[model samples]
Target: MSDDNKHDRDTPTWERETLQKLVLATVREQRASRRWGIFFRLLTLMMVFLVVWAYFDFDFPSLAEEKIGPHTALIEIDGEIDVEGTGAADNVIPSLNKAFSDEGAAAIVLRINSPGGSPVQAGIIVDEIKRLRAEYPEKPLYVVVDEICASGGYYIAAAADRIYVNKASIVGSVGVLMDGFGFTGLMNKLGVERRLLTAGEHKGFMDPFSPQSESQKQYAQQMLNEIHQQFIAVVREGRGARLKETPDMFSGLFWTGARAVKMGLADGFGTVDTVARDVVKAEDVVDYTQQEGLPERVLKRFGAAVGEGAVKAMTHAPIPSVR
Candidate 1:
């Protein structure tokens, strides 16, 4: 009787210890799983942060670190001169002021390489260049054309004290043109109805889908003529006796750099480096174009992503530019 009881008790105690060990093992396994899960999550978060940081790291050169010693202040006007862009009034005006005000800057070089864009933008830049030049009469501003300086490009160039160009550069499309497609014939063929509503007469004057009236056409022509005349006056005044004016001088005619010099569209053939050394008499050149930083651009893009719908609603597509 005692042996049987002891055996039964021992069996139950061993089974219970085995059961407790199993429970402890299960708990350890669950804890290990939670720790691994947290590690994976932290690693994933770190990877995502690194990816975002690397994507925005463009490493653009900073100009503030450079000292304003005796040098040619260079502000490049690259790409289309739009109302708001890299080389617009906001960027160019400030650069011009800094260059003009610099006591050590021998001269300012406006290195332009553009096919031209908005007349309004160009006009604004030209006005600012003139003002800065007048304010700092001692500091001469020269335009050194890279590729093609036409339309609005020429408009800005005319304001400079002198204009230089590349040997193969295209210059002087001294004209204003407003271009658009007339979709009436296409709509008639495709049977696509155009339902445009306007409050004022000639509000849809330049609407592609609507038919243009004779008076509307005449009024548009007159406006273009006025702009063209303004261009002519600027060119005539800038070039003065140097310009070889003909019937086609102000007729949107373009010429090569060599021919441009002959036509007085450009002063002569030269590059930024050449003009800086010879004309400006300053070997060292300092860029004054205001550029955006990587962090700032990233934050701006993030903000824009958050508010794109609002910006799109408020903004209107500008009319066909009369360049």
Candidate 2:
């Protein structure tokens, strides 16, 4: 070895300096490991706390809260009246029952903003409203139309004690319809044939790819007329002497709120706030609309996706609806 290298290797402080550097490196690694362990522990605890909070908070408004004071109970129908939508009978009936049963509710207001939907769903809701109104004769139930309350919406409103609306709102359209696309011509152009086999003669009735039979068409019309008559009876029973019978009233024609009142289809022009304050004589409004929890919302979304696919595959039968 060279003379200078040998002298440095023989120095007394070289071993002491090397040992000190190694000790410092080990200390820093231990500190970093401890910090990460604490961070992970805190994160786990936070997740647990959130799950517990959501579990306890998932519920409708309590009855005790509803009895706090006198207020106008508001139930909103804001979408298509179908089994899968917010305006479904399942959702509205419970809310109506709750509002009617609440002792502190001076009156109940149904705020409707819908074009319309299933006739069956609307009929069920209308029936429930009639029952509630009869059971709670002291408390009145009113309807306040928003932008548009037509067809199925108007059907429900007919059951109310009074129907209020804005002059610009589109009201009425007491009619039912079943619509679908015909693909026979398109299939002929493409030189494609639909070979559908059914056990019953009328099993494939109204199939879009095939010509509709005269007998099936007449049967469908008869069924619709029966439902239409039922609708007319409900409206007459609910409106009593207020309704002015017109030839075109149940011909699926919609009118403005102003014209509706003149025709005796609506009572007067008013909004949710005015009806609650002036008509019900209660300024405070408590929303009794059913609020779905997080789990329900997620499940419904998934279910809707699957249900839509299934419905698309079978488009032969067009269910009657009001719109």
Candidate 3:
């Protein structure tokens, strides 16, 4: 063979191998790019989903409607008034602040339906309402009792300028109560020992495992008396001379709406609509309650159920009854 033909044969083989290698390298590079693209797409989708969820959770629309004229804000106080529960001061105070601060809001109506819980929490709310009323003298605050408003619930209602209750509504439990079950007897029966340690003598004064001492009982009673006095002061200040300081008024006794009005514990027997229309001069009442969205409500319900089930399983006891 001639030198040119030999060169051509070698060059063709080399070029064929180079082309094959180039094709393989391109395929590998395409696969790597495709994998990265897929990963980024998935990450972007996840980020979008999270953003949407957060937006819905935190950006819930206001329950109240915007009105041009003087608006009546309906601030609902439902459930137990504890520090951690749905009727917590932390939850209700913000809504109350918003209602009072709204320039369009002519008056605030506290629509209460609670059996009451923490005295401190109720006091905090009552003080805020008083302060807000003093600051915004133009706007009046009213309480519309629904179903029941007793104990700490009445404490909050008494802070309002006036109170309205339904005819059969239960009202006026103006006393403080601290309740805890003593497990000493039960433990004795079960032969379970309670080992409690504290640095201070009075640290465990209210311990359920130990029998209440005379000194401890006296101290607790004094504290309760002080709290009761404070509650009476709030009622007197809020209701002014209108409140009849009868023995029955602060005797931890509840009364029906008719009797409550007679006793001066309530101003009148009426519903929210009646109060809003007649008292506030606005027929339309706007509710500014902070309600959770559907998804959040579902999640909270599911989580609470799971937690309650787990607790029941661990303790082998029924869930504690609501106060």
Candidate 4:
């Protein structure tokens, strides 16, 4: 009786252990399969994201070609007008050349919407406009101010035979300004030392971290005065006998479209369409602004999207404006 009972008990215990092992192995296999499925899904999503980005970043030219039309060249002057930034000379000058050269173009219109930038850049554009106008005397170049046209912007506008502005347009600043921040006090407070070197005595005259010397200030004032004189000369030349030369005209102050017209800062208050129709007697005006081709736009969009996505993923705060 004891031998039979012992054999039966051993058989049941062995069977139970084998069944338990099989169940455990099945659960482990299911978990592994689920993990691999999740990994594949994530990988597919990433690939799709990459493909979309490439599509936008690389196909701008094709899109532009499709959108371009005859009898109209759209020269866009949007955003800040700086040499290295939006209103770079390289970017706008070439387009201007193209606009002037287009034989089919009836009239070239400068659609300006800027708050002004570097004087050098503005001067270059103004000279080019004058030269081009002289070269093609029959073309009838015109400037149409959109939102704001101040300082360097007005300087550029004065080149045109006629300037058009919206009723509420901020038309003129008629001034020059060179801005910088002095950090000498801040550096001294923080016990930070400046190690700037220069060969000439006045090479670092405008260095923001150092105290400004009286001689340096005087020299800077002289330079600014010279620039102001140059500006006055250009304005007088462009305005001709039309400028009234009042006390406040060139005092670094601005005027609205209505006031500007009364002060002879602008020709008349009108819109692009009005000038094109009434003054030029041409119903169709061409835009000579060069635009980024489809491929460039796509690339830019993709890059921006990727950058924005990365910023979001990392939860970084947006950078503050420098201006």
Which model scores highest in lDDT?
2
Candidate 3: segments with Cα more than 4 A from true spot: 1-68, 186-193, 292-323
The Cα RMSD in angstroms, rounded to one decimal, for candidate 1 relative to the true structure is 7.1
lDDT tens string, model 3, 212-233? Answer: 7899778877878888888889
Ranking by TM-score: 2, 1, 3, 4
Would you estimate the TM-scores of all the predictions? 0.73, 0.82, 0.73, 0.66
For residues 1-323, write the lDDT of model 4, one tens digit per residue: 69978887778777978989999999999999999999999999999987777655443445544444434333566766654433656667887788777766557777788887767777788788889888988786677888888877777778877777776788776666656678889999999999977676766666778887888777666766777777777788888888877988887787777777777777787776777677766666565565565565566568758967985454322211101
lDDT of 1: 0.80
Q: CA lDDT, every prediction?
A: 0.80, 0.86, 0.80, 0.71
Best by TM-score: 2
Off-target runs (Cα >4 Å) in candidate 4 are 1-74, 84-86, 293-323
TM-score of model 3 (CA atoms): 0.73
lDDT by residue for model 1 (1-323), tens: 79988877778777979989999999999999999999999999999988786677545545653455789889988878764446577667878887788787889999888777877778888888877878888889899998888888888899888999888998888888877778899999999999977776755666767887888778878888888888788888878888888899888888899899988888887888898888888988888786655665666567646665564344222233424
Residue 178 in candidate 2, Cα distance off native in Å? 0.1
TM-score of 2: 0.82
Collision pairs in model 3:
none
